[model samples]
Target: MKRSKKRIIKTIVFEILLIISSLLIFAPILLAIIMSIQPPEFVFSYPPKFLPRGFFVQNYIDAFKIVPFARMILNSALISIFITLGKLFTGSLSGYAYANFSFKGSKITFYVLFATLFIPAEIVLIVPLFRIISRLGWTNTYWAMTIPFLASATNTFLMQQHFKTIPKEFEDAARIDGATPMQYFTKVLLPLSRPIIAGAAIINFTYAWNMYLWPMIVAMEDRMKTVQVAINMIMNAESSNNWGIIMAATVVALLPTLILFFALQDLFVKSLVGSGVKG
Candidate 1:
């Protein structure tokens, strides 16, 4: 009975801690939502108000009117979709080759590729990458944003790990059926890789959607700017002190990634767990 009481007490404490941690993490988002709904006058009123005074939906409306929010949204969505598709295509093929084929210096090649994960592309390679893009006359085009990020070492590494975990029997069965390597890969391996693929897609989409620096550097034209870059346009066009409008734009910008994450969270979790194990 004493041990049972101790366990119950510990569980209660853990639950309380968990709830507190969750609230702390969620506080900023909750505050942002509250601020987005507040009036311009209430935004910075003395003592500050944490609750909504009224449903000021006009802030959301004003966010769109202040800039080409729709166009920027389209640009962001298309760019993110392209990057996600490209990453999946290249990552899967590269991972398949590295995981299944044994060639000269295969291990060395894979190690080199994996080493790129430690390198920060934004800081180190930005200048040279920009130079290359400029030389190609892609500085103001979608290609400038999409091509450089088409392949992700992290995604490739994850794919390779998950592929390695597949049982040899599947490979043997494919061989016995006289299936070509590509056929076997497409028909057999890919079907079983849905979880990881979904997870990787969401990750790539979120990264591309949230990218600000590269898009800002490459896209100077208003029409070419991504949503993240264009969010600043809200502040530039509106009064900088209007926190409600800024928060409204922020909430709008944050929704896509949040929705995608919530929808695919199960697949994402499965991929993380499955990718770490080897057969």
Candidate 2:
């Protein structure tokens, strides 16, 4: 009876801790949503209002007017889509080669790619990357932003690990059917790797969408600037600093990622679990 009471007390403590942790994590997001609906005049009020007195949609409306939000959204969408696709294609190919095929210096190539993960973006920012992009005349272009990050070492590692979990018999069957290597990869392996691909896509999409520094550096023109850059401009605008508008814009920015995760969460979890099992 005493042991049962102790177990029950521990369970209650854990449940309370879990609830507190969740509240802590979600508090900022909840505050942002509330602030987004608040009137601009009351946004910076002291003793902070957790709930707005009245609903005002003008914060969102004003945000669009203050920034070329529509254009920025479109640009962000296009760039993110292309970057995610590029990462998926290139990373998967590299991963497949590493996981299935044996070739001269393959280990060395994999190590080089893995080494890039440790190199901070700041270290590569000033000289090699900028000069290479400048020499190619890619400055202020979409290619400058998209091409450089077309592949990711983490994605490649995830894909390779996932691929290893798949049975070799499938590849052998494809080979017996006289399928070429490319055909086998495209038709057989790619289909089976959907869960991992979806997980990678979510990660790449979020990274490309929220990326700030590189886009700011490469995209010089307002027309070329991404949504994140546009948001920074709005925040720094001299006319007025409307926290409500800023919060509204932030909520808008976060929606895509939230939606993407909700849609692919099951596949993402499955892929991560499968990768973890293999590792």
Candidate 3:
């Protein structure tokens, strides 16, 4: 009877802790939503009203007028799509080679790629990349932003780990059926590795979408500016400091990521767990 009572107490304590943790995690998002709907005049009011006295949806409309948000969204989307496809194709190919092939100095080559992960990207910002891009005449172009990060060591490592799990016999059987290397990879390996690829796609898309520093440096025109850089411009514009509109823009910025997460969150979690296990 005493042990049963203790078990019940433990369960209740765990449930209480879970609720508290969930609330803490969600508080900021909840606050953002509330602030986005609050009246512009009352944004900085004393004690900061948590609930609006009246409904006003004009903030979202004003945000669009203040900036060409639709154009910025389109630019960001195009860049992200190109970057995702580039990284997926190149990273997967390199990973497959590293996993299955045996060649002289292959280990050393992979080590060098892996070593890049340790080097802070900020440290290389001013020198070799600048010289190379300048020489190629890609400055102030989309290519400058999209081409450099087409393949990532982290993606390669993830794919390599996932690829290593497939039994060698699968490849051998494909070869026996007269399947070429490309055919084998496309049909056998890729199909089996969809989860890892999906995870990599999500990571690549988020990185490209939120990328600011590189785009700011490379894109010289207002039309070329990404969503992040444009958001900074919105903050600096001589508007009436309408917090509702600013918050609404922020909420707009967050929607794609939110939608992507909600749509693929289950797949994302499954991929991470499965990748770790396969590795």
Candidate 4:
């Protein structure tokens, strides 16, 4: 009875701590939502209000008018979707090869790939990468944004480790059933890889959607800019003082990633646990 009481007390304390942490993390988002619906006067009021003064939605309407935000949204969506798909395709194939095939220099090749994880692309890769893109005449185009990110070493490593965890019996069973290697991979392996795939998709999508610096540099044309890059235009405009409009735009930018995360959070947790490196 004493132990049970202590356990209950501990659980209660932990729950309280979790609630506090959650509120701390969620406070900025709550403030953004409140500000987004408020009037400009309310935003600048002394002792800034934490709660909604009133739901004035003109801020959202004005966000679209202030910039070619709709076009920028379309550009980001297209680039993110294409990059995610491309990464999944390339990462999965490379991961499959590493996990299943044994050949000369296979270990050395995988080690080299693993070594790339430590290199920061923004610092080490950007200059050479931009030069190549420029030479290929891909600057200011979707091709430049999508192509450079089509393959992710991190995704490849995660997938390869996850693939290694699958039991050999599944492969043996597929072979005994007269399935070819490709058929077995598609039918057996991929079907079981949904958790990892979903996790990787969300990560890649969020990364591509949030890209600012590269898009800002490469896509110099206003029409070619991504949503993230275009947000700066809002900040530089005459009405930049309107925190409500800025907050509304910020919330709009966050929507896609937030929605995706909530939708697939379960699978994402499963992937985190299952994709851990294994011998």
All-Cα superposition RMSD per candidate? 1.7, 2.3, 2.4, 1.5
Instruction: Write the residue-wise lDDT of candidate 1 on 1-279 in tens digits.
Output: 999999999999999999999999999999999999988888889898887887999888888888888889989999999999999999999999998999999999889999999998899999999999999999889999999999988988988888889997899999999998999899999999988998999989988999999999999888899899878888887465788888998998999999988999998888888876667
TM-score ranking, best first: 4, 1, 2, 3
Top-lDDT structure, candidate number: 4
lDDT leaderboard ranking? 4, 1, 2, 3
> Which of candidates 1 and 4 reaches a greater TM-score?
4
**Candidate 2 C-alpha lDDT tens digits along 76-188:** 98899999999999889989999999999989998898887898876665568888999999998888988988988988887777788888999899999999989999999
Candidate 4 structure quality by residue, lDDT tens digits, 129-204:
9999999999999999998899988888988888999988898999999999899889999999999999999999
The Cα RMSD of model 4 versus the native structure comes to: 1.5
Cα deviation at 218, candidate 4, in Å, is 1.0
Local accuracy by lDDT, each model: 0.90, 0.87, 0.84, 0.91
Query: lDDT by residue for model 3 over 1-279, one digit each (tens)?
Result: 999999999999999999999999988787777777877667888877777666578877877788788778777888888999999999999999999999899999999999989988856655688788989998877888888888889888878878898889999999999999889999999998877787888888998999888888777787777888778877888764877777777888878877876777877888988966742
**Estimated TM-score per prediction?**
0.94, 0.90, 0.90, 0.96
Q: After superposition, how far is residue 159 of candidate 3 from its true place, in Å?
A: 0.3
Looking at candidate 2, the ten consecutive residues that score lowest on lDDT are 270-279
Candidate 4 C-alpha error for residue 93, in Å: 1.2
TM-score of 4: 0.96
Q: What is the lDDT of residue 129 in candidate 3?
A: 87
Q: Model 4 Cα displacement at 79 (Å)?
A: 0.6
Q: Return whichever of 2 and 4 wins on TM-score.
A: 4
Between which residue pairs do clashes occur in model 1? none
